[model samples]
Target: MTDQQRAKPLRALVYGDVDLNIIDGSAIWAQSMTQGLAAAGCEVTLLLKAPVTTDRLVAPLDGAPGVTLRRPYEEKLLSDLGPRGLTPDQAVTLMTRLDAEERFDLVVVRGRRLASIAAQFEALAGRLWTYLTDVPQNVAEMTSTAVSELTDIAVASRFLLCQTEELRCFLESAVPAACGKSVLFPPVVVVPEGVSGPGAPSERLRLVYTGKFAPRWNTLEMTELPAALDKRGVAAELHMIGDKIHRDSPEWAKRMAKALEGTPDVRWHGGKPRAEALRLSAECDIGLSWRAPEMDASLELSTKVLELGALGLPVVLNRTPMHEDLLGPDYPLFADGDVDAVADTLTLAADPGIYGEAAERCRAAAARFTLEKAAERLRGYLDLAHPTAPAGTDPQRPLKVVIAGHDLKFFTRLADHLMSLPGLEVRLDEWDGLRDHDQYRSRELAAWADVVICEWCGPNALFYSQHKRPGQRLVVRLHRFELYAEWPRKLDIDKVDAIICVSPHYASLTRELASWPADKVVTLPNWVDDRQLDRPKLPGAEFTLGMIGIAPSRKRLDRGLEVLAELRRRDPRYTLAVKSKQPWDYWWIWNRPEEREYYERVYRTVQRDPLLAGGVVFDPFGPDVATWLRRVGFMLSTSDDESFHLAPAECAASGGVPAVLSWPGADTIYSRRWLHDDTAAMADAIHGIVSEDRFDAARLAAKAEITGNYALERVCSLWTDLIVDGTVPEPVDLQGAIAA
Candidate 1:
């Protein structure tokens, strides 16, 4: 036979943790991939962990032209074995028996549990290809030895590829050896033939949502969109095509069912087969995938969105970087995962011209993710035997730096900087420990790190201290709020090699509060990228004062308001622009009686006084802080206490003068010349700058100060020396460090 002919009818095994019949992302992916491979001249055998559940529709895979379906255990047996469907031993035994009967040319493992089993099959190691559908760290907890055994890896998205690279760096695994063997092919669906063109405008817009009804999926908000549309005088109907509630979250399901019971326009079809679901999707005018961006949402692509688009339906999903990468930058039907936003998008889709344009874009974008295209990409990854050049580890292997934090914005930026450095490999562990308590996963990450920096003195620090390997350096960074919480006292300081504080004042306070040696505490200023800041000031900006955060009472927003009121009394043009989420919107603040009372009083003050109401503008928090600062002439830091107030420095970088309040720690961070004793003093300082026409000079001086001291490059270099080079500098006095 010729090479092409011999390549035909190649035997392949597709393995996954979920059963083929389940109405979920993983199940759909497994079935689609199997069908795609079979279509590409492969005689495919789908090996599942458990048989199809009776409650769900059986996948239409029986008597397929070139595909066979098999499961390691029956549903009854799975129930007997416990929650984990098929144990590794059972999988190994079943696969071994199948291989003995007829050896397969290729083995494709889907999901982590299946990958672990596939690793045990030494006979299939040369042809083993693992597909990671979840976060790499969460999915695979295997050692370097096990990782090195796999022939290739397939990731679902570009974000997943970056995440996998970081994971490989942390583990010091053989990712370099498997370089070209890795591919990023997002979840694929079968594109419908003769996709109907955008339909003519209808009186009522029809929207469909197909997925779990879990709280994380924002199903509650999705169901409420129709009611929001009704209120807007726009007729709309919602079609839900999944289970009444997600199998995992029964309580949330119950709540959603009760909530949606009274909504007349919502039609629930429960769970349907894949093909049927697609058919139902084709009838809808738009698809909805409006879920909160959490739980690997940033990294993993949503298959449901693609599935809907494949049926020629425009999707009203949350606007995210991942979605933006798939669709064009200007895809018009994006929402903010809120009912009002979804409703607004749906209303826009109601227009024929807009809907037609969006429909065309959705179909075009969906064409890129068809199963055939994904299978072709998979074939390319499989063709390379020794794909990647081995990574060099000469002159002392690069430092494996793991940053563990709840809020990872700052740490994420720091990590990106560290990754760009010469001798550092960075990994971000963003587990807050409150929701996800995976101790084994935590230990695995800790074991991989040469140095682990816990961003907050919370459970992350506690986990690392308890699980840190011998000779591994531990660093815990304590910010302001952590000092007030019980976590600081609970943190085991003995295991910590160093504690990073943003300011010397905080360093001193942390040293006093925790049992760590005073020598271990060091102050490092937070980095700000001057290029991103340093924008041209808006016209008439000299009269505008900006404040960043205002939710927490510790921010002393009432005092800032008092300052604003005083300034407005001098000149109505002097407006106070507060860049933060409204106080009522934050549950943590509004739920507390004392904090709520204070917020209500401040709110009433804004309502009662016309000057305060008109002068004070509450703008929602946005990504572009630097751009937002351009409208202001001065940045106000009227907080009760702060370790290092970033808003003032950020304002300074943006050519805005810093007007700081005389809080306990503020003096240590800001120069005493700019620090005010009271709200009236702050107003006077602002007036002095504006009246004397020294605004430009003051702005230039502020910009110069921040650029010289806290520039991104400078801060990154200091962090590199401390984290990668293990350089321990002597602690400077609080006043001197602040002045520097």
Candidate 2:
């Protein structure tokens, strides 16, 4: 894991359970990840689990640089070991032999049983990156035996590649061993280049669905969408692509066969190569991904939605939380599994205005998961994990570190960064909530850690302080919320080594409240991964202003509307995109009379005001902010008060200018150039920049400020220095210098 070793391309071994010849989700995932790893500077060896009959799937990777396709079905030793699909034990034995010879830098295994078996081998434990999507998705399905097995696998693997944050949180909560080790490795969409279509939808709607047909997939019911659309006076055509059909029951098989018997409106292309299917999709009007409600409960996201989005086609999918997160709630085509709902959604999508908006949403969402971005993400993980060590150099046993917190969403990237550094073994103890933690697991991880970092000054801090072990380091990061709470008073300050605050203003407040010495309370601002956030802005983004998180009434939603109204009055093209959870969605906040009245007033203002009526768009809350920011040119921070507001910095990193309202202590964290005295000034600044044609220069300057002041690499190194060497980093100055 040294710089010397990293200079050469990493050797990666990828093995999955699916048959590559079959065009299915698992097989597609296997191929995409292999290519993604190769693109990330890895010499990849993709091993086939099932016997190979067709070269259709492996053909693309056969002659690709830094990639080798291996077929056990063709090899002498593998053929002698098995005739058909390789068994779990046999696969492990094969991997063991390969490791002995090839000595792979990374091993990515897909199946659960195979990963569990591979985790038992001491030789391969440190390099294994296990990806298990078939695990029990819910708490009800997570039996004790299941948890125990997953815990063992989590302990052995260097990383657990989770497809979604929901899945990662669920796994970390259910199986405590997996907390800090999991990373989000979503599906990689390789959008075909030079593929173009009409900018607008055709008069006759063209609908398409690709991939295998199964009962759960509701592909059979999809055949009825055309008739439903026809009854609504909408001319429509449904194109079904894929050769595989559900044949477990004779009745089902016969029904599907009849459905595929082509009609004028219903056409079955059977199966085409992945590339051809996408090209066909680009030419269509809408993509159908609606499935049964049972699938809604699953943690996995449909790659079809993203694939369709990549083609700039509006997708009509189930209105699940995950879907809403990907495309905003106002995406216009969300439907239930019923045919009528889907048909109605299609009818709405047929509208020229709605179609254009949905297509743009799809394109924006898909941009975040592109193959190039996937490679960059993988390379970042590798760089963090092997910062400075050589390939075979024997170093002291890696530092065992555990980060305990209820919500580590803000801190997980830091944890991942820490895990990537050489000579650090990281694990997480995920708490159930703010006041709830798994005491047993917390105790276990605390005992094993050389250093423990509690993300929030919550119950975990109190427990860890009371149970501090001799010679073990303990640090806690105190956000603004805990300063007002009783958690700090209950904490044993003597046992805690240091308290981290995000800003000097908060640090001064913490030291005053806790009556702690200056040395004990240090300021380390939140970090933004500039590499991940830096992306191209969308067309006409200069006219689009974005505000993230507008709940609790005090965030000054009214002020944001005022700014938008002023901007739109001057230029009708300007629109304000509010990306946040609706106030009503937060039960605790909505129950308050003042909060309800404030939001109601804001709603009234939006409806009655002509300038703001069609100009304000409320987007659903999701974790895809990096891509979502692409359409936001100027990020607004109009909150009445704040500690270290991170959205402005994040937007700046995304090459967008941040226009911040001058809240108290705002000057300490950000440059004065970004802060404004009021909404009027904020609007004037934004308008001035746009009119003067200095938007690009302003954005670049903002990005530079964020990069120089709060670069993730620099901030993470500071945390690493504290955690590994027990040397606290000096607080960074707002004027581009570190305080003495």
Candidate 3:
């Protein structure tokens, strides 16, 4: 045989229970997989149980390349025997004819009923591959006669692998001929080319959700987001793309619509072409896929999340192991599929800066699950399962990097980065029982870790410090608030191998305040993932100043107001955007007379001052600070004190100039040029950037400083070194540390 003739593409037949034209997940999966296989140099033919029909509502397959789609049975067959219509004899006869004509190399079956029937075909046994889209309950029903004939089984998720093993064990006990054979083959989609860039900032944030609106999908929570955003004075709208009302539960749709009446408007563009749906999604600010935990909580991955991410939309999905695996634990917008949680997530997503960063991250993550990547992965599994394939080498065990914390924002991102490194097994133990002082979970997690990192100097750190076994390294990270709290005082210094402070100033402050050896305190700044933050500034951002986190009195909102009032007096265009939780929202503070008195003073001052009336904009705490910073010309740090003052650095990263008020340790954190001794000098610095054409230069300078000193990669590397190599510096004596 000629070499050219011997190198022909693999010929494979894909069989599924669903029709290709339907607008459901199964149909999409079937079509997309067929296309992917064809693209991967496979001559493919798709066989379906249901016959093709011309319906206006059905999505058209106008340009499916290199794939022959066929229906082996009619719709009437389905009516007689339910969804699994074809008889084993009929299936055998059809396959025999096809095999005779094409001499097929592989037969891929999708559903359990079809797989069981196909398994009985001895001629196709060695070349068969069964893909289990659902649970393996039906697969267990296959007789020993059929089981012995099967070649390989594939599931859509790794979770199904365990379930498959359980099924295999049960079957083996009853039928000796049954063999356990399964592998993971997750659902994949073609990443759309030249999709619109990350969603741009607008006067009103635009949110879109595409998929089924069934009760299990939590469509009600999706519908309620816009109204909740509106309640916070964030002008937003939801564009729901899909079947507006679930065909199965039309009454539930009516109730949802009725509930949303008089709230922010929701435009329902009923189901459209898949291409059109993605294009529409690309135009929106954020994508939502919050579903009830009961629905595919274990085995199935949400294809909607992938679809939205591929289209360049940041997704607000439910918190789950699958989602955390896909987007990282630190992905800002995760909820429990509750209306209130989803609403709060949407509210945070409204910030243009945060939205932009999240959108970028989503797109980057989506790239890994593309059809091409999925096809490659499938090919590897198929190659391994092939009779003539070569043996594979054993891989090294992964590094068990455990990050234990209550506040997971920074640690999540760090853990995600660490996970991508070679031979690492990263896990996040977010201690929610910090308030109750629970140590059970913390101790258990500490025992599992080769390297344990307590994110905050709280109960998690204290518990891990005392409970961490010998040979396990423990690291505690202290931020600004933790220094003031009693937790630091109670922390077991000797148990902790190292301490991470966000800045040199904080490092010094920590040594002075705490009894830890100075050398143990490593000044590893919080990672600022520059890729997520660095973006183009919005128009009029030069006139707008922004302040993040203004809850406590120490943040000095009154000083920020003074600077804003000074600047507005010079230029009416000047405005101050305060992105924080409202003071009154904190019940503990609102209940206290002193704290309430301070908040009331600020509220009265804003109410009385004419300059502050329209110039001051209050935005609730949100996730999209990066996007919010883009619309801010100057990042004002009017805090009485701070360890690292992440807000200014974040603003600079987002192309905003820093205008910091001089505090006790301001010089240690910021450049003297950017720092001001008083509000007038802070206003002067702001005016210099805004009026003297120095905005871009100042912004670039600040970004350069942060990018150089606190890049995410640099900080994460320090952490990786500490965890993997134990290369951290030895503790210096407290007396020497104080002198230094």
Candidate 4:
């Protein structure tokens, strides 16, 4: 979608199982999330499960523009109800009714059972953004039944909102279906204006803890903090907020009530509005979120920690990995979840030097979780889940497109990109082998599609060409291997509307072999996911050269070694990094004598040559090229021949220079500045780049060349125009530089 289209407001339905009349974390979250969603360009309709007896906490949302709050009592039948809120089933029923009255773009459901119940409804299918905060917190709790339930929820939901990275990782590991669909929806804090900084050194240091009281929350233990601090000669006052206490253990609850009633040096303010609580907390010297040992292993984060930080109060919490990441490792106030540790931390925090440092860390960290940042994150995820249609397309009826291919490694990213775009619905017809496809599924997809894109111009392309329906458009992509195969010659070229090639060189070769019209043939290069690849370079990346895919000996692995050896002769800092499958892994290539001999010689030379010894490193091949590219300063494209070697473009997108050997048509695809005559020349060019401190300049230029021509969005836009409107992008000049 374009920027102009994104400016339009999306209709959002927000529901939580918490009572707004009560002041707690979930209740406060519901209120602040409504405002956050509205601020993120959404017209939010917040459905309340409980009756609104007090507007103390709900007053902030009253008459707020683009926000509509609906209480359960608004219905005549529920107006005379008791103090309790609607049940989970009742909330789902009400939510379904409202959805039918006017369909919302997305529904944000807060509870697991409520989300599961909503998912069962046909009207709410594929529209639920399930924010599950009460899932299995540890690996031992991930039972098979629990995993099945979460997987079912993930299948029905549009997106799963995780409160922390730890929670997201745990859920995804338990339920693999939630891997790509889950997103981090951390606790958001609304920093108030003019939060007071560190107070001057006084005899007494005040510590505050807000939120409901529970044994797991260690509110009872927090009451002992003030007394323990007194033993350490650090005079302190413990101020506690909120009146609701967990009733799981009646003895613990009674002890907490008694402790709050008449504890020495402690003051209890029974539940106040969130604003008032923050106001009281601002007067304190430090915040307290120390928890029990049981909760120490929990994957969730306390919203009160950031809330306290937003109030400019340094908090003493557990030193969990998540907390250590939020506050720097050097943060001095991290306690070990015991009264003694907390008292010691409080004593250290009483010192002016330690207090100032901790206060600065809290303030800086709080800036990242502000309301504006939360809104921006929500807006981005919303765009991905529910995108606006491009200018003239109908958003209601998205075009159905099917892609049928055997090995779709190259097309998977593009297919995912298409599925995320508005005005398009994509499906893939998987094939077992090059020519072995599910004929029934292929025919079914062809009949269901408005457009069919066949990758590799194999039997799938030929089958679709012969089975073309009356108004359906057929497009086939011809890779390098397909040009030499007999499948391309057997296709009925008249039935095909467009023939896509990865490079102009391949496009020319395809045109010469096939009787397709000049206008029907087009060159669309492979897209580089620039956003994923553009990461910070590692230390000494300037001396590391990367080479990928050396199977079958045609990739010219020996030439890459030669370049590395030549460069190492000039500067011993140079090294070669190869990520490829060993030749023996491929039976067809390893069975050949010449292929074995070529690799044997290359390995022997690497061990025998002093300049290349201990310099060549082989890493296992995987799909995580983005992370691997961080240490790859220069990517070598020393292939003997290639239609479009995508490694160079990916390297360029990763802010690494491409040392490309001048293979035939290499000049047509890449800039001449990156192309070299031979291995020696390529090595010399890299040496010059390092010696003259021109690495950064070359990296920037190479990145610009790739991002300008082959970014994911740019190429996807071209594909969208082609599949949606039957508009072929302008053809490229094969004789000149193809990047232009």
lDDT of each: 0.70, 0.85, 0.68, 0.84
Model 4: per-residue lDDT, tens digit, 86-154?
Answer: 878888887888888988989999988887788778788778899989788987888998888888889
lDDT of 3 by residue, 1-740 (tens): 11132236668777666655445677677777677667666678776655555332223333456677555555232334435445655555566667778886677666656665666556776566666545333444555544443322221111112112223333333333232234345667654467664566567878887766778777776777777778888888888876545656678867766644534478877677777777788787788777787753445666777788778788888786556766878888887746777788777776777788777788887777787886775565433332121112111566676787877766766765665554566777876766543466656777788788888888888778888789888888888878989999998898888898877778888999997788888877676767546655656889998989887788889999999899988999999999999878888767878877888899899999998878889986755565466678888888887777888877877777778887776666566667788999989878877788988777777777766666666676667677777666332222331232
The segments of candidate 1 whose C-alpha lies over 4 angstroms from its true place after superposition are 1-3, 53-59, 71-85, 136-178, 191-201, 247-250, 260-262, 295-297, 385-740
Better of 2 and 4 by lDDT: 2
lDDT of 2 by residue, 1-740 (tens): 33245446778999987778777788889999999988888889988887667665677888899898777767754645555588888888888888788899889999999988998899987789999799999878999999988988998888899898678767876776785567889988886687744557898889999988988889989999899999999999998888888799889988987887855688998877778878887888899888888989879987888888888888888887777778987778888858988898888888899989989998899989999999988887777655763233224678888999999988977886776665677898988998777778888998888889998998989988888899999999998888999999988888899999988888998999988887999888889878657766767899999999998887888999999999998999999998999999999999999999999999999999999979999887866576678789998999988888888899999999999998877888888889899899999999999999999989988888888879888898788778877777776656762221
- Estimate TM-scores for all models: 0.47, 0.60, 0.50, 0.76
Clashes of 2: 5
Best by lDDT: 2
Which residue pairs in candidate 4 have backbone atoms (N, alpha carbon, C) closer than 3 angstroms, thus clashing?
A: none
The 10-residue segment of model 3 with minimum total lDDT is 386-395
Compute the lDDT for candidate 2.
0.85
